[model samples]
Target chain A: MSAALLSAEALRIGYRGTSMLPELSFAVAPGTVISIVGHNGSGKSTLLKTILGLTPKLGGEIRIRRDARLGYVPQRETMDPIYPVTVGELVETGRYGIRGVGRRLTPPDRARVREMLEATGTARLERRLFRTLSGGEQQRALLARALCAEPSVLVLDEPTASMDEKGAHEAMGLTLALARKHGAAIVMVNHFIDLVAEVSDQVIHLDRDHQRVTIGPPAEVLKGRGSQGRYSS
Target chain B: MSEKLALFAASWELWRGAVAAGVVAGAVCGFVGIYVVLHRIVFVSAAMSQVSSLGVMLAFWLVQAQAIETAHHSEDILPLLFAALFTGVFSAAMAGHASARLSDRTKSSEAFIGSVYLLSSAALVLVGDQVTRGAHDVANILFGNTVIVDLPHLLLFAGVSLPIAVLHVWLRKDLLFVSFDPVMATTLGYPVTWLRVLLLVSLGMVISIGTRTIGALPVFSFSVLPPIAALALFENLRSSFWASAVIGALSAFLGYVTSFLLGLPTGASMAATAGVFLLVAKGLQRLRD
Candidate 1:
């Protein structure tokens, strides 16, 4: 089998000396979209944070297969509104990792930013300050920022949690398009069941007890456990 | 008439130093102020300025008078440098240690900075009382005499301010990232804590050197008001930086002109000009809003 693009082995997460989630293992394959579905307090957010190395892990090892560039959009509510940056500036900042310091962006970096902005439907809003945008607009702008980096694996934490229904659908469509068009590995922590069922290629349901219940396809995942109902429901 | 011209020429020479000081001070303040305002570290700036006063007083307490003719400028500056380096490092270290240990549970950082500020100011007063022969010289250091900003001080200001200006320009985007979203900065692999520490040290040096022309009191305005004024009008990072420079330079020029015309205190007049600029900028921003 081809090597996974991004893989985590025996990951353990915690806060204040207490383990919130037990040792877990997962891998994200290139061009695949994996949606992590779980109830509240199921350590979904912790899992994402651990993958990004935001907090010190209790125990685990994560390896990126191809020295893959990583991009992430944090939860909407966690972003500060007081940040004084326009969408274009925010998107262009993604090039920081690529360009390093004392070097101006070449034609390619500039083109990448523009293309990402266009793809994310934020081309017209590029000049607008981030905090002034509506929730959905800000979310799209952040995605544009991520895409500017040309990330191999794009991870998002509840991108749709604060958005309205229409916004949620639009965001999911954009995310799926990014995965398809760029061959990016997409991992998202999602609370909504219907949305994941509609878009995800693979569904992994997490339990409060930190057990992984691998649900095969949208048809099987949407069906409630022990229910005799058909997939049409 | 030629006497008036001579006075004008002398005053013009003084004006050059004042303008130079203002530009260097303004540039340093603008760079440091962006992060200061972004991080909500106004108290840190205040602590730094207060601690800087102790540096001056300690210099006076340490330096001794020598023969009048051979008064080397370096001899005078040596103690000030030592005092500045010592007090600045000490206060910053204390604040860092206290914040790391006690800030999570109790409001230790604020308390620590406040206590240091008070202690430094009290120490300055006691040192002033004890050192009588250099009372006027101490006052000059406190509220600098711009009329006499010599070559050595000018070189010193440039030495400290130029590196800060270059770093700010080079790291403009990175600094902007940390200023905007520190969490995002970290995830993107920028070291946030180290950047902050570097900023603190650079800010201390900037204010220490700038204390010569603008004096201790006006240095606060030179550090804060220009950035505030720039933010009032501009939206982009580059534009904001340019606007801040213009505001800072204009305030300094106008302040010098005001003092020259009315025989007012130069430092206070400069600060008043910056304050008025801030008010006008605020009013315009309100109109736009």
Candidate 2:
């Protein structure tokens, strides 16, 4: 197997020194989609945060490729709309890491931002205030911001939370296309079991009652697991 | 008005110090205030200003107790140092508290800030009573005597303000990213905690030294109102930053001129002028909408 883009061994994730999920291990590879599914408070988001080093890991070894760059599309609700930034300006910030500090966005950076905006279908909304965009639009803009960084690992938490069925499907299609084109690894926390089973190559299901995690191909794990208990619709 | 202008122009050397001080204070406050308003930590700034004032009063009391000659320019160092120290400690504490993940049962952070403000205000009064010889000196500490701004004070303000302004400009995007979306900033490998601490510390240092030169009220006003006005006027953050700095500088110059012509308190006039700019910006935004 090609080297895993990201790997976790006996990972324990939580906040304030308390582990919410059972010990888990997984590896993600380029051009592969790994969907994390669980009930509320089942450490789905915590796991993503832990992997991204946003939260503390009680005991775990998370190893990313030395040169892997990360792009994150955080939960839409977590971002405050009170911030005064235009869609273009907000998306332009993704270039900061690549461009380094104290330097203005070069032509290439602006070109990338424009390309991402176009890819995300937010080209028309570039000049609009970020706060004025609807939830679905904001989600798309945020995805554009993340993609503009040209990250090797793209992690998203509920990318379709505010999107409708059609919007969500379209967004996922675009994401899949982008991943294939860029050869990036995608790790997402998703609640929709059907969608997870459809789009993800691998699925990690967290059974809160049993305090256990089941990881395997979507066909093997999600089969006959129709909408019951924590996986219930 | 003409006669006042002639007098003001004739004694340009006399008032130049105050003008320089006002412009520097305005620019620094304008730059820092964007973060303050965007981060929605206005109360933290207020608390910081109050703590800084208390630091100044404590320094004055210590100087009086030691019977040190206040006339010497070197004496100003003691108060500035104390203010910076006190403000730094308070800013660190506030930053830590704000970053903490507390239980729902704990008192909100605003309550803690309020308590700090109340305690600092009362302490300032108590310290002023013991240290200051009369009400005039207390007024000078609270509101600042713009006329007393000499070349040394102007140089000090410039020395502090320039570097901070440069840092803000150079790190504008990183700072904005950290302030607006810390989670994403961290995910991108930016040190969110350190950036936040740096921002708070810089704010404290600015308020500390600026308050010593321009009084707490004007510093607080300049740090808040101009950013708000700029936000009302501009759609983009970068434009808002530049516009805020310009508005702050203009407000200060116009306010000083108003103070000279109308025989009003300089700090209060500057604050009022900033308020006017905010109102005008709001009106313009409304009309555009």
lDDT tens per residue, model 2, B133-231: 667666766775566588887898789878988898888888888888877777776767677788899999988898888888788888899999999
A89, model 2: CA deviation in Å?
1.9
Two-chain DockQ for model 2: 0.52
| Second chain TM-score for model 1 | 0.85
lDDT score at residue B80, model 1, on the 0-100 scale? 51
Stretches of model 2 off by over 4 angstroms after superposition: A227-233, B67-71, B97-112
Q: How many angstroms is residue B231 displaced in model 2 relative to the true structure, after the best TM-score fit?
A: 0.8
Error of 1 at A186 (Å): 1.8
- Clashes (candidate 2): 0
Measured against the true structure, the TM-scores of the candidates, in listed sequence, are 0.84, 0.93
Task: List TM-scores of chain B, every candidate.
Answer: 0.85, 0.94
User: Could you tell me the lDDT of residue A139 within candidate 2?
Assistant: 85
How high is the lDDT of residue B274 in model 1? 82
